[model samples]
Target: MATSTLLLHPVRLRIVQSMLGHAQTTTRELAERLGDVAPATLYRHVAALVDGGVIEVVSETRVRGASERSLRLNLSRASVDPDDEALVDDERVRAGFLAYLASLASAFDDYLAAPRSTLEADLVGFRQVAVFATDDEWREVAATIRDALLPLIERSERPEGARRRILGTVSLPVD
Candidate 1:
């Protein structure tokens, strides 16, 4: 499975977020999806993802006299090993969680960049919290979170649609 890369910086994370669940995309298309990302940076991150196996070139064709490669997420190389204790460490997990936060924020920023005032937010809200719990209860709590949100995430799926907009946050300090 693909461990998140040391090179999976902000831009690359955005690229992957755009590419999720898709069959493939050309460099130009990816750049368009990732508005404000330079073509060169897109290509660089795509190459890194290819190396990382987070994405694979499903096909390559010459488009407009330039090489255009189609890309898709490769599940074969995508996962976080739950048993890997390092992934559970406070520092490493915090970094991974931060990466997730960056991805979610980037996705929002990209959507807002779209030329559509046609969209309206029917509701907007926020929550703040500090959770303290025993280790034995942590697994159950995590399970509750997944069970609660997975269906909400599923509701946003639309055929032939761009990725849905959903934000999630999870943080628990080691006290």
Candidate 2:
């Protein structure tokens, strides 16, 4: 499978997201966290990720007559290669973007299904702003956003008083 195809499937994407900011974890642990997904389905996607070299098994142990593997993303291969992106045609790019939108919608649905009071107390937000900027200005804005978020992304694994949050950004030229 192409790296983007392997990584962008909804289930696999969620699996990768769950692993992003943490130490190595076993498939059993992942299954527990993603309770909505069937164990077999989760295992199948995980196997595809491992086969595609996006994730690696860091360790293995015998557990109740089965081998449990602790896996983590191979950071080097976890993202689509820039060279590969250059080779992708426009249709592929649209498909990839659609997949991303679907995942975003699914996440929002899950959040809304949670307790109303809890959702209200959380810092969740969505907004859109139309910006008129030259290419250079747009690049500067992108860099500024990245700089502001990099520290928080890097510190995501902190154990104390830390909550997991999903941050999504999409920039597209207006027609």
Error of 2 at 65 (Å): 1.1
Candidate 2 residue spans exceeding 4 A from truth: 35-38, 82-87, 116-120, 156-159
Candidate 1: tens digits of C-alpha lDDT, residues 8-93: 35676667677655556777788888768787777887888888877888888987798888887765555455565555557766
The worst-scoring run of ten residues by lDDT in candidate 2 lies at 79-88
Q: Compose the digit string of candidate 2's lDDT tens values, residues 31-141.
A: 986788898999999999999998899999999999999998876777776477543677766766676777778778877887656654788888999988998999999
- lDDT values for all models: 0.67, 0.81
The 10-residue segment of model 1 with minimum total lDDT is: 117-126
By TM-score, the best candidate is: 2
Assess the local accuracy of residue 67 in candidate 2 as a C-alpha lDDT between 0 and 100.
Answer: 96
- Superposed on all Cα atoms, model 1 deviates from the true structure by an RMSD in Å of 4.5
